[model samples]
Structure formats: structure tokens, C-alpha cells
Target chain A: MNKFTEDDLKKELETKEYEYGFYTDIEADKFPIGLNEDVVIAISRKKNEPEWMTEWRLEAFKVWKEMKEPEWANVRYEKPKFQEISYYSAPIQKPKLDSLDQVDPELLKTFEKLGISIDEQKRLSNVAVDIVIDSVSVATTFKKTLNEKGIIFCPISEAIQEHPELVRKHLGTIVPTTDNFYAALNSAVFSDGSFCYIPKGVTCPMELSTYFRINEGGTGQFERTLVIADEGSFVSYLEGCTAPARDENQLHAAVVELIALDNAEIKYSTVQNWFPGDKEGKGGVFNFVTKRGLCEKNAKISWTQVETGSAVTWKYPSCVLKGDNSVGEFYSIAVTNNFQQADTGTKMIHLGKNTKSTIISKGVSAGKSQNSYRGLVQIGPRAHNARNFSQCDSLLMGDQCGAHTFPYIEVKNKSAQIEHEATTSKIGEDQLFYCNQRGIDTEKAIALIVNGFSKEVLNKLPMEFAVEAQKLLEISLEGSVG
Target chain B: MLQVKNLHASINDKEILKGINLEIKAGEVHAIMGPNGSGKSTLSAVIAGKEEYEVTEGSVLLNNEDLEDFAPEERAHKGIFLSFQYPIEIPGVTVTNFIKTAINSTRKAKGLEDLPAKEMLKLIREKADLLEIDRKFLSRSLNEGFSGGEKKRNEIFQMAMLEPKLAILDETDSGLDIDALKVVANGVNKLKSKDNAVLVITHYQRLLDYIVPDFVHVLHNGKIVKSGGKELALELEEKGYDWLK
Candidate 1:
């Protein structure tokens, strides 16, 4: 750095592009463009779903047709053309493989490039991975170990056939199909995702993870994930996502439901890194997700997410505390850069006596992006002594970028105690100079500062994913400073 | 080993430090004193390569190499350290983590491997003990909610860790009780060596009583109008800048 090398000799890029920009050209089984009742029925029928499941899809499709895309979020973008997007696109299927070696080499390479090698993950870590590419879950590792303890973990499509009673009982119960436009859409046409059922008194021994990749262009990925933890059981789930670079914006609508039964606990985390498009913002992913968890008496559910991508993001991972003494927690760090827009936060509904919830959200905006934290905390009637603490912090990297907060609190019970704190700040030039004077480069200094700003939330992630989340924060803000 | 030759600088096209010429060899301590707005801080910032001040004329050399093209961080890698008058707050970065990063970054810039964690721990323990900093204080967020004295003490702690060839302390004694100032000055004194020099910029002579400068230069307006032995600071302390003017 002291040598003052010429531009040609400077090895680093002046500005970084999305690292996961390469597209995989594997042959896929793509349906023709458009969505209708037939497409919903076809998606269910193609999975060889039961008659009741197909009926369920038809009902959701009817609900979706009547619902409209809500525009209450703080963002501006053109409406997506529903008729131009293919509802389902899956990698070309080979016969059931006994091991990952038999899986398509191209599919394996796609995961490899994303740094999630299925074979390595199986051997090295105690993390059970469900690899979902495009619209299908290709592999589920550590199934036998989980099955030995009466736990059921597999693809939702397979769950409908093999564990029909469990699927039938829990599906659409937490997140009803008529929840919203995107939820109804996801329910009607979700091709494939992961499903887990933890038996009573059984704690999952390994971290259950799902890696999602959208490789096929012009196709919408609607995935549904459901986790049911029985009484006194515990489970931790992690989700990660990425998409190939494309000029035409793609749509991603996913629904995740968690049912933590009495005395059970569930920790859910997501690292979302969909393409945020080129600097001029011509194309990227529109990530609209409905994620909520239901907690029974004495149950607990915690949702943590690090979102650094998606040109437009509208997500709120919420918790409904229907049982007394239940606990809810939402810790998030959302970073938006280069024309990206995000309106993401969490909701905590306290309906039971002594229910407690905590919300810590951090938003970092760089370039021309807009980031907002919109959250709600509701204390229902008869919920005596319900307590909630929420902190919303926003950090702006440049003058052009923006950070906003919208917090809604409703308390019907007089005994409810809710404390909320919010602050907006810009990265000070003195702070950067102080770091530079210490020999840390500006890029690394920004990362350090951001990590420090987001430490409270990052600490909630699993150790392995925490490292990746920190790196993603750095990459998302690279070249944002001069 | 440090040379600032006829330096002229400005901020927002307004001139500060119209002309400053100073030099310090190894094993020397230099103090620049003046009243308010005398450009003592501007000189320190210019030496540290802060972007705000545009150096209009003259050159600063460290070990015979001109430092015009080097960035603030590059200048840091070339052994220039500036302790700010007001330290910035990083809410969640602990002092231990910040110092480790600073040391490792300097090492990395020199094409050296990161110091092993064990070595880093030992160094941190030694420096913290020398500075009379409690172990628990190292774990708190850097400068967040810290008292003024704690902030200045932490700056000296960082200087001890970096061990720069030339350390510039800008108004290091602005807010300090006798006990805390002694701890800070003791820390700085313990780190001074034959291979490095110190530049202390202060408006008051209270700190110089402890730091004991070898040379004192009186600054008026943006220029250093008088230079003399360490007695110059004592004389100005009694007579004030009005006498010099």
C-alpha cells in the first residue's frame, strides 16, 4: 500500500461485484410461463401429492386469486408480471440416488461454488443439510441419525406421502394459507422445501440447515418450510439462500411456519443473499417472505436473520405467544447496498400472561439503497405482566443511502411493559480516520465498525454461520467508501 | 528521524499552519504550545494524513522518504501514529479486539503473518499492566460511554501496542485529573525509546511537567513564531502568548 502502485498493478477491484454472480447451465424441467388454478394443481400433482394435499393447494389458489399484493412497505418498484413467470422449475431428475456421488455433477458444482459441499458437510460437521436447488430438495443428510430418535426430517413433498398424518396436522395451521397474498401464493405453488418433526422430549443432536439456490432464470421459487417441535423438544434450524445474476428480476416468495409446543424451544436463523443486481439496478431478486412461529405454554421461539441481498425485501419473522410464560426473540441485521430496498423487521404478539419478547434490529444502508426496520409489538387483553423490549438502530454509510424505522406498539393490558429505543447515525469521517491512522485500511475498518455495530445480533447466530455473516457484511459494503 | 519542512496546510480553502518547520531526532521529545486556534492540532492531523487538511506546500519526510502519496493508513504502516483529541466511539468493539486488529493490520501491511493469539495475549497483558488498565476495562466497548480520562488512557494504550516510530499526541491532557494524567503520562513515558520520538501538542503546560519535553516551540496564528529549549514552555506558561505576540 505504501508503494503507490499503478492502476494495472493494483490487484484489488476498485469496486466489488456480487461474488455469487455465476449462473449454472444445467438442464431443468421448467413449466411454461404463467400461474393459474391448473398450475397449482399441476405442481401438487407433479409431486405425487395426496388428494387432500391437492385440495389444499386448490383452496390456497382460490384465496390467492382474491387477495391483492399489499403495498404498505416503504419501497418503490414496478409490479411483477405474474403471467410472465414460470411457477416451477427443478433440476432434471435422475433416479433416486443412494449417495451424493450419483447426484448430477453440475448440481454438485453449483453447491460447491456456493461453498456448501454436501459431501463435505456430511463428513465434517454435525450440521444436517437439506440442499434445495431451484425447486427441489436434492439431498437430506443425517436422516438416519434423526430418524433413530423418532424424528422425521425430509422434503415437504416427501413428507406429504410418508408422514401424511404429521404434515396434515401441522401444514397451514401456524401460517394459514389465507394469511396474505404472498403466503397464499407460496401455499398454492410451493414446489419443494424442508420439513422437520421433533418427537416429544427429543432434542435434535445436529443443527438442521437448508441451502437454497435459484439457478433457473425466469422462474419463481415458492418454498414452504414447516418445523414442529413436540412437547419438551428443542431444535435449531438455519437457512441460507443465493441466486445467479440475471438481468430480469426474479420473484422469491417463501412461507416458513414453526410450532414450538409446550415446554419446547426453537431457534431459527437465515442468511439471505439473493443477487442485489448490478450497480445501476437493472435486475435482481424480489424476496417476499412470510415467516412466523407459534409458541405454546412455556415454549420459546427465537428468530435471527442477516439479510444482505435482494433488490427488494419484505419480510417479518414474527412470534405468536399463545401460551403463558412463553418467550419470543427476534435479532436481525439487514444491510442494503446499491439500489437495494428492504423493509424488514419482526412482530411479537403476547397473548398469554407473563409472556416476554425482545427485539434487536440493526439496519445498514450504503450506496443508493434504502433500508427500513418496521416492527410491531402487541400485548393482548388479559396478558398480565407481559413485557417487551425493542431496539431499532440504523447506520448509513453515505449521504445518498437512507435508513428508516417504523415501530408500532399496541397494548390492551394496563400491566404490560414495553420499552423501545431507536437511533439513526452515519459512519463518521473521524471514525474512519481514527481507524486509518491505526493502519487498518478503510475497507477493513468499515467491516470492523459494522461488525461492532451488529455484534449483538451476530452473536446470536451459530458460530459457523456467524463467520459467514460477518464476511457477507464486509462484502456487501465493499467499495462503498472512497 | 522525523522532518516537517515549511509545511503549509488549509481546510476548506481557509489557511491553517501557514508555515511549520520542525525536526526531532531519535530519543527526543518535542512540545508545540500555543493558545486556542494556534493550529497545533492541524499540524498533528497533517502529519497523520487526515484527508480534511490540504497540505498546500512543503514536505514531511520519515527516514528520508517523502510521505506525499501515502494514505493515512499507509502513513501508519510507515510508522506515523496520531492520538486524537477526541476519540471516536465504536459501540461494540472491545478495546482488546480493536488493539488486536490494529496490530495485526500493521503486521499484515508489512507482509508479516498475524501475531499468534498467545503472543497477542501476552503483549496485551503486558501493555495493560504497564498502563495500569484493569483487565475488565479491556473487554468494554471501545470509547463507548467511557469517561474522558479513560479515553485518553486508552489512546496511550494503543500507542504502546502500535510502537510507532513517531507518536503525535494532540492535546492529550485536555481532560484529566492528576491521578489519571499521571497514569497516562507514565504509560507514554514507559513506551518512549531511543529508536522513536514523541510530539506533544498542548495549550497548557500542566502535561509538560510530567512529559518533560526536550524542545518547546511556541506557535502563534498558523506559524511557529518562536523556538527554544524546554524553558520556553515554562516562560509561556507564566507570560502567556500575549507576551510573544
Candidate 2:
């Protein structure tokens, strides 16, 4: 204590304070905190889902009841009390109007903050948006254009209603309902998420994005996102998430499954900016998500993510190479600052002969935050000639922060080839001095270095989301570096 | 425009520069020649405000202001530039973006307005031509996959862009052919003006043939042992640093 100065105490206090800690005010319907069979039935019935869908939900609930929470992720937190969370929270019913003004004002305001409101763009050019507020889809834009191209882009609820066969065929095929704890929960209680289906031999004309905003407190968001690209089809989807600043930690358990058939390609990206808890680690989001993709013969699937928010993050967007000559790629940049802890990466399972996968991950930690990259590449016994390359790099700014990399590679086939490289180093004073001598201040210099570090992953993101991600990265590392 | 009075600097508890005194007026080109263990680079690094080097004693004045209190970036805004001996390779960041950001940042620090994209593009193109740097190099990441000569040229291009009041070339001629050295020298000469100063730090005087210096000083054992006119560099080139030792 004698050696500790006032500056040290102030620094400790500053590390605990959360920058984005302002809550959004709204009133709406919310279910009692907790999960049970009745709650599952209530969620399905409230959405007016078909009887078979309701039965499916019940079956998943039954399976979920028999399973235990997964303990494999390198994240530890107070397990969210599932029974104390409200899975259903929506605005008052309104007419299904065709224009933006017909939507609820609260939902509109949320989208406004997200920078993707329909009112912001009179004629949406290449961007199509689906707004998911709380546990339900509020609205989707550019419906006519997607319909013209014979591409189905809508909410999963709507997909269940209009394209039930497509949903039934592909849903849970890649990631089963009981694959993991969060996935199992999402399987039984997911409220709403975006769904896209590209017809065979057709290339989607524009990028599709889903913006998710968690508005209600003490409510867990279980979003189920599914994408299906048929033979010779191509589609790119962007998913972004945010929650109003609050003191009560919220739970977000999402399940996303992507399937690319022969000669089809799919690119899925996420810019996760969930509200991490304030200093003292109070009131943030515990984000546990299961995102996986399946590439059929000659198919390609790529996943890119920029994860910055969340008090604790546990996710690994993965791929299953099932078809011969299929390709899988993952590029990710995860930044954690100020009492934030994130353990994220991807898994690539090569099952078809001659399949390949590549992964590049960059992690940055500052301000008492802990960031890690946990990835796995598995080559199946039958997958001869399988190939994989992985690179994981970590950048540390201050002594208080920690950066880690853990990669697991398993090769069963004698002909398979796998290579992995990882390095962890601090942003040396020399590097900072170099930038500073160029007239960039300490803060701006750190941002430049970080952006340069994540450029590969950021470049894979959609233009709109990439810009937002860049801004988020800058804000997250504000006064922590240099 | 630069003054160091009995400046003492050290790294890791070991003193590298001891009781060094130097002065440079505007429009003067000063060359510091030294052997491997000499502190020529240490002087440039300390003046550039590298954090690794601690100024244990004495003071540095740039145009009559206390230089110790300024940050590295503030010193840069005061028109000080160091052409790194080995340019860092920043992957994935284009040279255009890096230089533009650096230029605009300096401008902003000086309370100047931001440069428009079109204006910056035009300016960069003009400077690239002046330095004989290929336009494609501007689009690539800074020093990424560049050859030895290309890296040196890139450093010169950056020096041309910054147009600093004091330019410190730390061994800028160490890894260049005769032709490349001439091109770099030409670039430096074009950037020279009556209001700015240039400090050439190198062990070899080969670079002096291209950009003749106004003064040459011999640094040995962390101190300047000899000083003379331009002919001094030619003399050192002929006799080698062994004579100074």
C-alpha cells in the first residue's frame, strides 16, 4: 500500500467503469423469468406457430430437460438462471403495414441507433435489413427485391409459415438441437431470427443483414438463424448485435446453422457489440453462441467476425467439410478491453476427401481484459488428402491485460496435412514510438495498429458493418493503449 | 535549429551517450560518422523521444524550447522526422493509407484542416514521381515484401511527404546501391530548404558523394572526437574511422 500511488488507484477505478452504460427505456410484455415446458408452449403459441412446430418445440424441450450444461468453453461465469429469464417480450400488436412508418416507434428508434433504419435510406440499394428486437423479429426491408430474385429472406417465423418444408429439411441438420447447452436452450425457446434461402443456380443480388437489439432486461435472447445456399448459389449475410446499457447481466444464447450445397458458397459475418458489464463487472451480457456451417461437395463457407463487447464471450463459429473438394475458411478479430473477457475462435472438421480449411485469428487485450483464441481443426479418418492451415496472433497493450492462444489439431488420415502457427507479443514501445513520430497521438496510433492487425478480418465484413466494427474497435481501446 | 547541451542518455541502466553536445542551424547538413559501438544512432533516437532511451541528464532545445517535455508525436508536429534505419513492415495497411493518416495526423496536431481524399491522392502522386517511387508501391502495404533498396526508397518517399524541419537519416545509405543512393539523395536534396536542417548518421561516407554535407563529425565512445568541413567526410572516407579511433 505504501508503494501504491493515487494514480494507481485512479487507474484501477477507471478500468472498472464501463463506457457504454446507458439503458434504453421502454415498456412492453415480458414473460416470467424462467424456463419450463409451459414457457416453451407459450412462446410457440404466442407466435401462432403451426401445431407441428409447437410439437417440435416440445420435443426439443423434452430433450433439453435431459441434458446438462456444457463445460468445455474456456469461460467461467455464473450460469444464467434459465428459469428466471423471460423468453417472450414483444411490443403491442400492430397492423401489418407495408411502409416503415407503420412499424412501432420503439422498434424504429432502436434501428435508428443501429444505423440501419429504413427511414435513413429512401431507396435501399444493395442492403436488405431484418430488425430483430428482443426475442422477436420486428420487420424486414427490401422484401420485393429479394422476391424478384427468387431468394427467400425473411424471419425464421415467417419461413416456418411459408417455407415449412425447407425449414424442416435443413433445420438442426448441421447443429443438432442437443449439440450443446446453449444450442439446446435455443432449440427449445428461440423466439425469432433471420432466415435466408438462395435458389439453385442463382446468385443473390445483394448483401443481407440482420440487426439484433436486446431491449428488455432480465430476458434471455435465444435467436435461431439458418441459411441455405443451394447448388450453384451464393449469398453473404451479416449479423450485428447490441443491447442497451444496463446493470443486470443479460443472457444471449444463439444458434446459427449454415448449409452450402454443391458448388454453392456462403459467407457469414458477425459484428458483436453486446453491452459488456460496467466496471466492477456488474450488468453486462453473457454471450454464449453456437454457430456452424456445412459445406457440401465443391461448396465453400467462410465465417468472419469482429467481437468487441460482452462481459464474457463463449463462441466458436465452425464448419463441417462434408463434400469432396469442399472449402472452409474462418477469419476473426476479437478485442477485449476494461474488465471484458472473451474466448472465441472457430472449429473446422474435415470429413470429405480432398477438403480444405484455413483460419486466421487475431486477439487484442487491454485494460485488465483477457482475450484468447481457442480453435480446433480435425481431419477425419476417411478424409484422405485433407489440408488445413491456421494462424493465431495476440497483441497485448498493457501489463494488466492478458492475451492467449490455444489451438488443437487432430489428423487421422495418413495423407492429411495440417499446419498451425501462433504468436503472442505486446505492442512494443518501439512500434508506438514509430507511429507517434509520424504525428499520430498515442490513442490514434494504437487504433491504427489494431485496425492494421484486424484488417484481414475486417475486409471480409460487409461494407456497412465493417465501418461500424472499425468504430467499435476504436472506441473499445480508447485510452488503454500507448 | 537543434541544440543538445551535455545530453546524457541511457538504455537498461547502461549509458550510451555521455556528455554529448551538438548544434545545427537551419539549412545545414550535419553528418555523424562512427564505428559499431559509437552512439550515433542513440543521439537520433533520444532526440526523436523513443521511450526506451532515458534522458538521464542535460537538456535538448529545438528552436529554443525545452524538448524533454514533448511527446514523440509533439516533437513530430514540431517538424522532426526519423527515417528509420529499418522501416517496419505493417502488413495489410496500404502505404497510401499509412502516409495519408500520418500526414493528416501531423496536420491536425498543428491545428490544420484535414486533407481531402482527392487532394491527398494528387499530392501523393506528385511526391511519388519526385522520388522515383513506383505508383504501385504507394498502394501496397508499407515495406511489406519490399526489397532492401525498395525499403530505403520508401523511407525517402515518407521523408518527402513529411517535409520536416529536421530530418534524421539513420544509416539511410547502409543498404543501397549507387543508383539507389543517388535517387534517395536527390529526394533528400529536393526536400531541403533554407528553414530546415538534415542530420545524416552513417558509418560510411559513400552517401556524402551524392548529398554533400556542410559539416562532418566523428563520434567515438559516446562522444564527438572530431569535427570539420565537407572535406572531412572525403578525408574520413579515404582514411576510414580507424584514424579517429
Please, what are the lDDT tens digits per residue for candidate 2 over residues B188-231? Answer: 99999999999999989889988889999999999999999989
Stretches off by above 4 angstroms in model 1 are A1-15
Residues A1-482 of candidate 1: C-alpha lDDT, one tens digit per residue: 11111121122224377878898878989999998989988888889999999999999999999999999999999989998999999888774666887788888888888888887787776789988899788887888899899888888888898999999999999889999999999999999998999999999998999999789989999999999999999999999998988999999999999999999999999999999988898899999999999999999999999999899999999999999999999999999998999999999999999999999999999999999999999999978999999999999998999999999999999999999999998899989999999998888788889999999999999887887787778778887886
Model 2, runs deviating above 4 Å: A1-21, A93-95, A121-125, B12-15, B237-245
Residue A286 CA displacement from its true place in model 2, Å: 1.3
lDDT of 1: 0.91
Per residue, candidate 2 scores C-alpha lDDT tens digits across A1-482 of: 11121222224334334433444565667888778889999999888888988888888888888889877766667887777778888765462557776887766766665566675543543688787877666677788988998999988998998999999988899889879777888899999898899999989988888888788777888899999999999999988887878877888899999999999999998888888776566778999999999999999999999998999999999999999999999999999887888999899999999999999999999988889899999999989999999999898888998888888888899999888988887777777788888887777677777888888788888776676787777767877853
DockQ of every candidate: 0.59, 0.40
Say what the interface RMSD of candidate 1 is: 6.4
- Model 2 scores what on Cα lDDT? 0.85
